[model samples]
Target: MTVGGDGGPSSPEAGPDLDAVRYLLVGYSADLLVDLDGFLPERSVAVVETPDVIEARGVRGQIGAVRCLAAVLAAPIQDEANAVRLVGLVPRPPRIGAVVPASDYGVVAAATLAAAWGLPGAGPDAAPVFRDKAELRRTAGGAGIAQPEWRLVTGPAEVAAFRAGGDGTCVLKPTNRQASVGVQILPPDADVFTAWALTAGAEEQMFRPGDAGGSRYLAERLLRGPEVSAEVLVRDGRTVFFNTTAKDVQPGRHPVETGHVVSGPVTEEVAAALATGMRALVEATKFGSGVLHGEWIVVDGVPHLVECAARLPGDYIVELIAMAYDWSLLHGFLAVLEGRAADPAPPVARGAAIRYLSAAPGTVDAVDGVEQARAVPGVCDVLVRVAPGDTVEPVTSSWKRPGHVIATAPDAPSAARAAEQARAALTIATHPGAGR
Candidate 1:
């Protein structure tokens, strides 16, 4: 998930090209794929995906310099078998010097592929601990890392048992899913049977051919306090926090992250607490290297682990971090990918924020304010998802976000205000319709 665009041609920190390193990125989508023109030499990256998909994401247009190897990547998350198949597709000569997963789903595959190629990052051994929430809790608990009380619940009976033990309310999350896809907070009086039955056929957490409908849920105590995510750069088991972002979310059944503000003002006390917990998490998981997007909730001033991803944070966090720090995070990621040290020092201070646009489930009728949002002061970018005819659904995960506005200012409050104003200026008209 090392960045491509900022390193493509603009930034002075793009550094000397690492053309000698033939890196293989096992990916799920081309949506955020960057043109690694300046980071890596042309024709050096071979992306495994279908031709149409490559075109659909503007991959050919955005990252046409990289090679696109047509193949059907069916699963969002892949197992070792998928990794093996992806490895077989690589021609023997060039020899991939590094392996990177383009998304969370591709992490296990990247690790497995790296192990096969004798690359630097964590191998298949670290996959399960990072991929499965249940496994993650077990490992962290074994290491005495503080976490919300949790248990792997396979059925209604187990859910009942878990509730009877402690808090009547619990949060249920898919073991392998990201973006809080199947994360739901069950109330004390909610029907466990209905909850289990409704989530029984959920397939977004699918890995291999089997285990699709098995116990994909992990029930845990609903931790209080503000939610935040740490964007850390880890190299050879050493980790550094680049930025901590405050999240604005609606965790009503389906967790929907609405906005983010770069948290620059951290009390030294809270900082130490977060560092201790995050460091313990890194050690417990044995995440040898690469970028980690760690989610945490600070309850009663103590940070508890939510989840950590062995990849970059989605939703333009990398880009936002760069705007805030005025430092090349993507370059740091690239350095780490090559098993080298990265200067994560902040050279400048600023704030960047992103606010997502949510729409009611309906059909897009008329839309306005794209140009207006972009014109707002500090507004860096404005993305609109719905069109005149496209059906817009209530946001589930980040999939249904109507659009988002990114802005930056000298400080966090200003930046957040800019984002809010920018998003508010936009207008979306819709009619009631079926969810997408």
Candidate 2:
């Protein structure tokens, strides 16, 4: 592993002096780190990532200005001890600005390191609550926040009992996994054993073998309603910016998100309920500073908590939020993390939406219409991650989806329509009969 200060000599006895660094970025996202480097070109950044990710992403070559520190860990960084060790690679803690997580797996480590260093971040005790769904449910429930009925299960019989106790249907998911990897919605007559096996065996592709979360699971009574996520920025346990994002999910055993629209309209009552729920969650978690992405199901104008994350949201939602509001969420997130107040969100200037690309499960033969999709009115970007000879699997999770199209317009419906139209303009021809 390579570890050194900025343009300094490497020595085993004398480690790098990180005193000049202002931010310690945890996790690996090449594009995000580069953007952050651009945002604060003058400020020094120290990044902690696995050696494999550093090599695969060419992180050092991409972000020349950012100092790259690699650590070969016995466990994932989400593990608090491993997180501490990863950040400890820096000879000394940087300035008292912030420690930021670039991905879901970095939240706990970032929070823990920030607290230990006396920098602004989610409280050390509260970061794990955001990562673990069961704990989040308990915390939110204790705060009198509404949520669907849920229970932890370790075996098939417990899942069966939970389903039986519910209204003949339930959702089973891993307590700590993200991107819907181990999530499934079972009907009244669904096979409990098969569902349990599938959910238990699921794993995230990003992690190395044996580095994923444990086999903990939760069975919850599935609530029905329009699903939305609240993107919020908080400082000193107070909300400074909040926006409601409308969501679309695949209707099947796995509820993988398909799209999201920022600054979308909601009824007055539902908006109020969402605000109240957000406040309750912030207080319950005792979150100190940074971004909070909370999901909810609005039933009868009441928003029920669906788990939240302390890190920046995935799936280009941050970019969409910036486009819709004519401001930078990244800027606000950095500001709050640096112990400075975030700028109050302005009124929605436009609507921004993203629609993901999907094709039948098979081997891709050809891709077409990408440029045409980009030419569509209001279409800002269209990205197709698959190519000829690539295998396209069933959309069981966010990573399985191939690509997406982003659009902006005067209103939410118009932006959503434009995004869908642009997505329809593209095509990925696949040879059928490849099973998932």
Candidate 3:
């Protein structure tokens, strides 16, 4: 971590007061930590992450009083044994009031640690279900939630069989991967072998070095409709807060998210259906107090399951939710994780949206108009991750998208327009050549 802090006493024996309320974050997330600092400014935080993540995404200097512990918690597959071993690495802080995962790969480990330490979390049983899509499908199906036809495929033959029965259009994805990695939609005439090769070969090895679920894959019949996600906060198996976020994805073989608008305009019926599906999902997972990012495809006003995550939503959705609702979602999340009651419902105070920045595949020559984009009316923030001399690859996944602009207005449409206008103000000039 670039940001330095007191590596709290080498061992628990040498630590400070035993009654201090310290939080254990199971992965390295600068944004999460910053929010934690704002929510509970006085509380101490201890983070457990692999050396690579800390090195790649350095910690910011603003988050006060953080302790960094470099440890190996990610593995080829996640299980209770690995989780237990990870817990043993913690230096036994006095009172760990809550255990939260800062990343998708850390969900199971964080839940297991929380259970072992008797802290508030999603609970051990439900965490694994949240990570594995196949298990989630079975659990959600048993709960009578609507979902597309899906099957576990061992190879191309199984995929072919699945397509043979249906219209031949199917979606293939890894059971356990984040950032839309290894997710692809195959049309009827698509080559099954080539698609399988691409899906199986995709991996987010930077933070999660190996296949978290041992190369498990799911093939599902494609559901045609708009995609939206519910940002839900649950306490003791009951949902206390819910907000629907409308999303847009790049049109191609890969379903990479390109934009998101929180509390966007939707029919009352569609909103109710999404709420119902989210409630059923919470009940099925038996998830305890925490945040759930559940996604669905609305087909004829019915919400069909896409997948869900047990941690905070990515793509700046949390920030947008806070801006739209005029409340800190991170604060509510921490409160719930600490076994406290969160506001049963928070009204939307405004509209917020985020639009990602992209460029053609080539080498970046220069990035211009970032300042002008930031100055656009209603544009809250604008960031460009690419710079001169950097390579700009095709937008195959969320990570490949360069950066984004976040905007807010009195309503969803206005906010979305503002985001787009701000995005249009900037230009990422690239050389006409294949990216490295």
Candidate 4:
């Protein structure tokens, strides 16, 4: 079975006769639903839906298998309710598996479902540290690990006070958000009060969906150095599977990732620093099962913790890593989920880099040279998530990326150079729009 996101069907074999695997897709939309029926193996493809109206349309003879989508934790509570209600309609269904993130809502749903279904999950108190950045910082710090110096500011007045001192350089980030969605870097000479409003106030406005806003936030001093990420699989008090990669942040942003490259070649010193820091985070959080993707910065040879994510890394990061190292992280994750052990294959190369295709700051009119860029040597695949006429917003959050260019090579410099050449080879044309 294959899971598909916006780019397209992750697996090419959507046919009905693919009796080898059972695919559980998160949500199937345009990329999988359109003009895909003929290609589907008659015995392999199955359609799963949680919406009753969709189910009522008749699923019996339309596909090989049909199952109600039951999610323990959906991004929104409304989605969770819909999924659970739909699952109740299915008879003699297989036992359900819950998906957990570090979000507050995700924590509650995962823990509650584990208790109800007798499944496994992290304890309630430990889950909070993953959700709350402020809590996580304190926990890691108390464990003798280094973290960015940060404070929890309850109000705009406190934000002003925190911003007033120091080199006038700090970062304001939402405690509950990821991918640097509500994070902003401060200017050295900027007005403390005004900048504070834009940084902290914007965070409140962004997360205030359904009248729930104005949550607590964190203001941390930014760390300087090259960023590194570790994808560590922990189970039964042991680091079962581990893959460390280099994180490429946005040019001017603090920790907002534009893309990633795996198989990072680090000296013995840096690698040791990373291992020590990761062990600290795992011990402090008491996370026994599942894989975690964490970020850190090598500051003057010392590694400092950025943040930790208790789920699979976002985007096609897992796919990129696989392409570079010839290791399947998705398969590894499924193995761990089933209480089996996962060991990644030996590293094939020293480095692999993924470069994002971002539109210039304006309204996108057209994109050109995609075919030409793909023809470049060493470039494996080019995925353009947005279309020519799609309005290109200025890069604010990590998801603002238009697409990605993935390449692998013998070393980091070679991979980075190839990615740059490929990025420059393509051009995006933006016309005048309402956007500035």
lDDT of each: 0.70, 0.80, 0.79, 0.58
Report the error of model 1 at residue 323, Å. 0.9
What is the full ranking by TM-score, best candidate first? 2, 3, 1, 4
Each prediction's TM-score against the native? 0.84, 0.91, 0.89, 0.76
Please give, for residues 42-154, the per-residue lDDT of candidate 2 as tens digits: 43666665455545555555433453332112124555545566455544454547788777777887887787777889887788888889999999989999999999998
Kindly report which residue pairs in candidate 3 clash with one another: none
Error in Å for residue 93 of model 3: 1.8
TM-score of 2: 0.91
What is the TM-score of candidate 4? 0.76
Against the true structure, candidate 3 has what lDDT? 0.79
| Worst 10-residue lDDT window, candidate 2 | 67-76
Model 2 misses residue 166 by how many Å?
1.8
Pairs of residues clashing in candidate 1: none
lDDT of 4 by residue, 359-397 (tens): 776676777888887887778878876665577876767
Deviating ranges (above 4 Å) for candidate 1: 1-21, 35-39, 49-77, 81-95, 205-215
State the lDDT of candidate 3 residue by residue for 1-436, as single tens digits. Answer: 1212233334323333323546767777766766666545354666656545544555333223443232222221244336666555555457667788888878888888787887778888899899889999999999999999999998988998998889878899999888889899888888999988988898676665544346699999999999999988888888888899999998888899999998958789888988888888878778887999999988988889999999999999999998999887787887888788876556898899999998987999989999989988899999999888888988767889999999999999899999999999999999977544
lDDT value, candidate 1, whole model: 0.70
